[model samples]
Target: SCCPGWSATARSQLTATSASQVQAILLPQPP
Candidate 1:
């Protein structure tokens, strides 16, 4: 029973979180 707005919001959040995780993984660690 999910509406379009809720579905889009969930997808946006998911993508944002995934992109952030990938960026964190690829960034160099500071010594």
Candidate 2:
């Protein structure tokens, strides 16, 4: 399990990936 801070990091990464759009193609989406 992750801590509360992990959510912030995940959100940031999500934002970055969403902006780049290529990350989803490079990596498989987690389930």
Name the best candidate (by TM-score): 1
Q: What is each predicted model's overall lDDT from 0 to 1?
A: 0.87, 0.83
The digit string of per-residue lDDT tens for model 2 on 1-31 reads 4599999999999999787777667776898
Rate residue 22 of model 2 by lDDT: 77
When summed lDDT is taken over every stretch of 10 residues in candidate 1, the lowest stretch is 1-10
Segments in model 1 whose C-alpha atoms lie over 4 Å from true places = 29-31
Model 2, global lDDT: 0.83
Residue-pair clashes per candidate: 0, 0
- Score candidate 1 by lDDT: 0.87
Which candidate's lDDT is highest? 1
Superposed Cα deviation of residue 31, candidate 1 (Å)? 8.0
Candidate 1 versus the native: TM-score? 0.74
